[model samples]
Target: MGTGANCVQSPYHVTGSTWQTTSTHFRKQHTPHSLMFVCFSVGWVQGSTDFGVGFNLALDYGLASVYLENGTTVDIAKVEGGQVYKAAMRLNDNNIGMINGRTTYSRSEQINFKQSFLDNYIYSPNRLGGDGNGNNARSRALSLMLKALKTATESYLDSKISNAEVVVPFPASESYLHDLRQAVASVSLHMPMSAQPPTGIIAARAHGMYGKCFDDLDLQGHDKSMKNDPEQLILTIDYSRAALTALLVDEECGVFENRRVIHDTRLGLNGLHQLGSITATDLLETALRNITQLPLDDGNGAGLKYISNLVIIGESAGDPRLHDTLRRVLSEQLEPVTTVKSGFSPPIDPVFAASRGVAWDCWDRMNFQVNE
Candidate 1:
């Protein structure tokens, strides 16, 4: 998506099947490549205002390149391209004809068949504001998301991918999955049973910590470490216009077993700024406090332990002051001296972390899974 709207599509690397950090164990158990990776069939698709449709034209304007733009130019992505472009891109099953005076636009121009309704369309219905269309609006939004996915999959493979395994936010509910399935059906895309998108924080951790591919050079003095400790765990907090989510991951096991919370609130970066530093601090502190009580399994029938690290990300984390405040507050509150980390995905906003995580997941599913 875009940094302005606070969505990340993290960059990923595929070394056989394992995602992010690789290990000797995974390497040793090599299996024949799965057909899933045979033709780049598995992919991740995300929408965003920050990632505008990229169009590059030569000086002669003879050779033109056009495709869904990623988080390259923030200013361009933030700009609302146009109502026509947006509406047309928000693909629905119905036609959106315009009657201007006595003349009407052609069917091709009026047809709502391409999905590009920005990133907001995928949100739950309640997250949708009082646009007043209600169910119709929600249905249309989901349709657009599916359309966008189809278009992205087709582009990524450079061919039509009839079957795909899609990634969604972690802890996606049955209803959300059902909606996605319907969208896939609407677009004539087949979703495999095994294909699933990991939650937002895990994906971020893979790119930021494990893969070490996440770029955060802009976050001066940011605390990002590549150390992996089995007994140690990390907490990741994600902020966006859609919601606030957190999770804990075991470094050694590479498993995200606990979900801190998925607070459904429209309070985005703008909302945080509006709430001022103190209120935001209190709100964040409340969320982090919940982590202190989370049970930690040491795998030896032993009791829980303190989280070793805490990483904060999303568009809101861009504010150095906010990042610092979060770090300080969490440090003061966590049981053990939790090292706080703040960083964004470099070359792209930290927003792409989720998308990249899913892409890597698809690659892993296709190439790494041993049918033992």
Candidate 2:
């Protein structure tokens, strides 16, 4: 299962749903597996929307659709819905859309819903080692999120998952990542838990970026361009409401290389949403400068000089208002550079793109393990 600021995704086995492997190399059929990728989303700001990918997945495959929760499913196009930093969940038998937003709650419920936006349980210096009441709610909320996914997954699989691996966004700190891992373990759903990778040292963007570079035609074109010209670079932006991650991609002797994951705290998604247009524009300008000016060695004496493609992703990137603002600001900044061939483009299904990419990454890893 993968949860993002905008959506929760699982590889669900939709009964009678047909799927096409992007790569023809995989067309030689295997023992059919029941799971297909699905996404559930909610509005980020207002916390008032809920939808799923089941109906569209079924419709796309010309299969009969089945409702798993509350009979709500969405058009595949709606995966690009502009919402960020909010997770969708079922609470008190009713669906909760804005898990991240602040709302009034009973003293008991406050703790659980208070830190709902982030998977990391906020801890103070005093509560670090002691299991405090304040920590329980956040922990429980995380568990509940996992429990919900497990229930849906098991229902679709018709069996319990013995070992479940969750791919979480690479967090800011190691301790926070450890806390996130522990939260999943505490759920005790009888599935051994694992996270994508350790925190801070890597970027969650890597999984999606690698997945895209693996097959996505547009991204593949960038790779081919890089192979022909070593100086060519691809800029990938992971634009989530919580944070913005930037990566530089290149091809070294026909092999795709993710050069580095750039970190800039000043470019956080919450900061962008909270700031006025002028301030946000300024922040974006600074971010663009930071992105284009990354000090990466491309083996040539000249460092990165040309960006062939720019892939914008994440739920926030899909927001027309935000997208326009950032694009306008970025265009203003890039006009002087004059090297990047393609300008900013809104991500294709920004919400599910990352989750689907992550799913592909997991599938590859699992296949590797099986072959090994």
Candidate 3:
């Protein structure tokens, strides 16, 4: 079971007949589960005035059990209404005030909750060797889970089976899978290994939870552009021109300091300005860096040499200003890095030439790394 923020609690009605008596009687008969409890606190501060509110919530799932009798076993999983219960405790004086001709609002909020369930029923044989409390708890939990799984399996099989194999599936991160394998091995050595080897199921899921985010961006589209025109330089710029424009208007007029107006236009202008200058430069530099450091390799370093000089490159090929900067830099600094082939045959796509020229010009303007 895991503990987190969202927890359910019982509802209360203030204007009800004999509500207090009913609440008391209900509490007496129902034993609350400590695991499924939540506490929340809220507070607000304005100037010197402070106000606060707090509450506790609890949830309970009905119990289930397995019993062995007459050489037979029975197991059941039953849950209650799962109705949430809540109680509020308040200590505050509500008040509002302004400070420094501006409004200041502050509030504090907190919630803590834990789950009440023994969800896992399998234990790994491997254990970390350490006296640390964390490690001990983990080892103990694993043992319990394994024991539970064994019992469940024996009950399910309905045979006089003293040992049965169980397989645990884990995602395919190499490091994690290795660790799990070791843990299982350790467990097997401690306990009798099943006559037949237990299966280890590796999930086919990809690494990195955010892999979908990259896929959603559709970066593959850029790959085609890269192949069509290797060395296609790209640059992106955001001037925050809109924000600057708004600020300019504000400065000219008396409404320059208006909070609402400033807040609305400030973000747009700031973003634009950043995109035009810093963002543009960043894109150019990234492309250049990638070009110089191509042929990336995996842990084995097997394919590095094969693709080392197959020059297919691109950068943030977007803005003309940024492209020009890159061009100047290349002409000055990169000229000495490699011998330029004279009378070279151009690629079918002429755009690559324009891309190279732009990058070279940009590089030259800044004297290529001298001012970098």
Best by TM-score: 1
Instruction: Give the Cα-based TM-score of candidate 1 against the true structure.
Output: 0.52
lDDT of 1 by residue, 176-242 (tens): 3444445445665543343221334434454444322323663447656633334455666555433
What are the lDDT figures for the candidates, one per model? 0.37, 0.35, 0.21
Model 3, position 287, has a per-residue lDDT of 38
Give, for candidate 1, the lowest lDDT window spanning 10 residues: 55-64
Question: Which of the two candidates, 1 or 3, achieves a greater lDDT against the reference?
Answer: 1
Q: Against the hidden reference, what TM-scores do the models get? A: 0.52, 0.49, 0.18
Q: Considering lDDT, which of the candidate structures 2 and 3 is the better prediction for this target?
A: 2
- lDDT tens digits, residue span 62-175, model 3: 111222222222222222211111000000111111221233111111112235232121111223343322233233333333344334434553532221122211011222
Angstrom error of the Cα, residue 239, model 1: value is 1.8
Q: Give the per-residue lDDT digits (tens) of candidate 2, residues 232-329.
A: 45555655545555544453322333344443334556556677977877876665555555344555565655554556655555655545644654
Off by over 4 Å in 2: 1-141, 170-172, 188-232, 249-270, 294-296, 321-348
Candidate 1, residue 36: lDDT:
14
